[model samples]
Target: MARETWGTRIGFILAAVGSAIGLGNIWRFPFQVSQEGGAAFMVMYLAFIILIGFPAMLAEFVVGRKTELNTVGAIRDFAGGYWQYLGGLFVFIGFVILSYYSVIGGWVLRYILGSVTGGYAATESAAAYFGMVATGTDTLIAHAVFMLLVIGIVALGIQQGIELGVKVMVPAILAIFGILAVYAFTLPGAGEAYAYYLSPDIGYIMQNWQSLVPAAAGQGFFTLSLGMGVMITYASYLGDDKNLGIDGISIVVLNTSVSILTGLVVFPILFSAGVDPATSGPGAIFVSIAEAVLDLPFGRVVGLLFFLTVAIAALSSAISLIEVVVSYAIDEFGMDRVKATVIAGVAIFILGVPVTMNTVFINLYDILAAQILLVLGGVLLMVLVSWLHAGEAIEELEQGIGDLGSIGSLWIWMVRVPVILVLLVSLYLGVTGYIDFLTGAFAEYLGTL
Candidate 1:
């Protein structure tokens, strides 16, 4: 059997953009901006994206295109020996991410259904409605439905399945969100909301630079879908003719644009309805946005569109997460694509069961995958490229990017030193934060006992 290559360059670019633009952009990025001094955080984040994110992305691309294999096989072929296990770890991180990620996808699906049925409109408290839906039988049914959708698409094989799916999904997501952004501008407090979102608070940033920098760096990596083998797997299908540097920039730009657009839609609606963005927390979308929609003309229709946007974004990303593992199974074990996708999907769905049943386990898994494992995976990948295979890595990069010049030397040095240092700091912060959370939770449990 021959390995699959993407049918067109546009197909490959859209698929990568689809993977990058997801729940992280819509749900996580806006909240981070709100908490991290708005425009100041945005500035720092863009800097990291250029300096750290792009180089790290290119390194993954080099590994994938050079070897033309899935994460484990790519490392095994490129470096051989014990280093291959590191690639295996990257694949496992993707699996863990998809496990909890699908659960959230289920929540988004339920919201779309509720929007159509006026379930959220009838509720006296949107928060209470979310609480009921987030666990138990409702969650399980939604999770199953979401995972089946992912499996069906992936089972169709690469160009027919993943490529075709994102081609439709990416355009629809943009059109829908574009409509929402235009609608948000007509709301009563649009100007104020824009100012609040776009204005820089130099004082706050100066005071909080220590915490804000790491948060921005981590968010930059997470938003691009790096460190979890998604990019590596996607790039493995590419031909040597493609310019990886150009495609990488395009992915980052599209992903960042969507993130900003989400804030345009979210903050304006919240302000027009007199909801305080600060107090909304993670409930900003479910509670605040849901309630705000009910008071507007044609609210149900708009609510339906909003949740539909979320559903599309979540699905686009979920496909990539599942693909990382599926590709690995096909390459490493020579499993058939359909069989690999089904087995992987079912296993991931089963893994999500405990998360859906208990919120504590969900939080723990989220911290491990997002904060800890992702940073560790990224750090190891950079080390492999910079230390173990610098000569080969540079050669691979040059195949797509052409001449090195001074820029190439700068790229190599940045990845080897500054990028690795930033990731190490992120790993330390993630570990300490997780430890503190666990210690506090354990203390509470002991008191109850």
Candidate 2:
């Protein structure tokens, strides 16, 4: 059998963007913005995306296209020897991420149903409702259901399944969020929310620059889905004619737009309801924001749209996460796509069971995947592409980017110096104390009453 490739360029671009625009955009990004200094964080994040994220993305693309293999196969084939372990490390990272990621997907699915049934409407407190829902057998059922949806799409193979799924999902995500943003702008306190979100406080940034830069840079990598092998697996299917640099830029632009638009939608709704935007945890969305939505005119309808949009975004990203492992299985072991997807999905589902049952475990898994492994994977990737395989990476990049004369060298140097340095700092922060900070925050939030 022949290897699968995307049917069109737009399909590939949308699929990549779909992977990038997940819960990170809707649930995490807004919270991070509020916590890290609002507009100051946004400015720093955008800078990292351009300087570090885009170049690193191009490096992944070059590796994938050069070898036409999954992460394991690509590294082994391209560099040979001990480098294959790095590939296996990526697979491990993807597995760890999807394990807990599906649990969040399940939560989003529950919210989608809750919005329609007014499940949240009857609750006296959104926080209490979320606490109840976040545990027990019901959460496990939801997680399984969400995992099965991801499996079904991935099992259909690349073009017919993953590509087709994202083609529909990505458009729906943008349209729903766009409509919600427009509606949010009409709310009573929208102007204040917009100012809070868009107005950068340089003094705040200067005072908090040490902590803020690491958080923003980590988010930049996370939001782009750069470190987990999703981009590498997606790019492995690409042909030589496509311009990877241009596609990388497009994906970043679309992903950033969705994230910014989510802030536009979420902040106004929270501000209008007199809810504080700084409730910077999972509860912010499930409890605080949901409670706010219930109080507004036509609140049920708005809630439905919001959760539906999140559900789509979650599914789009979950599909890509599963694909990273599935692609590796197919490429390295020559396993059947259906078998690989089923085995991987079931394993992830089983792994997520504990996460659904225990809030503490859930936080641990999230910190591991989001903070530690993500930055490690990114730093290793930069070293591989920029240092060890620079010649081949540049050659692969030049294949489609022939018209750009000096851009290839510029990309290489950027990856080698600025990108690698930033990723290393991100990893250092995560290792030294960031995990403790996150764990402490989770403890404080979860321990209350």
Among these predictions, the greatest lDDT belongs to 2
CA lDDT, every prediction? 0.85, 0.86
Off-target runs (Cα >4 Å) in candidate 2 are: 438-449
Give a tens-digit lDDT track for model 1, residues 1-449.
99999999999899988888887787667777776777778777787888889999999998999999999999899889898988888888878878887888888888888898988877777887787777889899999999999999989988999899999999998999899999999999899999888887888788887667767776887789988888889999999878888998898889888988988998898889887777624445677778888887677888889888888888888899889899899988999998999999999999999978876776688668777888888999999998888888887777767887777677789899999999998888888878887999899889999
Candidate 2 matches the true fold with a TM-score of 0.96
Task: Kindly list the per-residue Cα lDDT of model 2 for residues 56-150, writing each as its tens digit.
Answer: 99988988888889988988988899988888888888888788878888888888888888887777788877987787899999999999999
Poorly placed runs, candidate 1 (over 4 Å):
280-283, 446-449
Model 2 residue pairs with clashes: none
lDDT of 1: 0.85
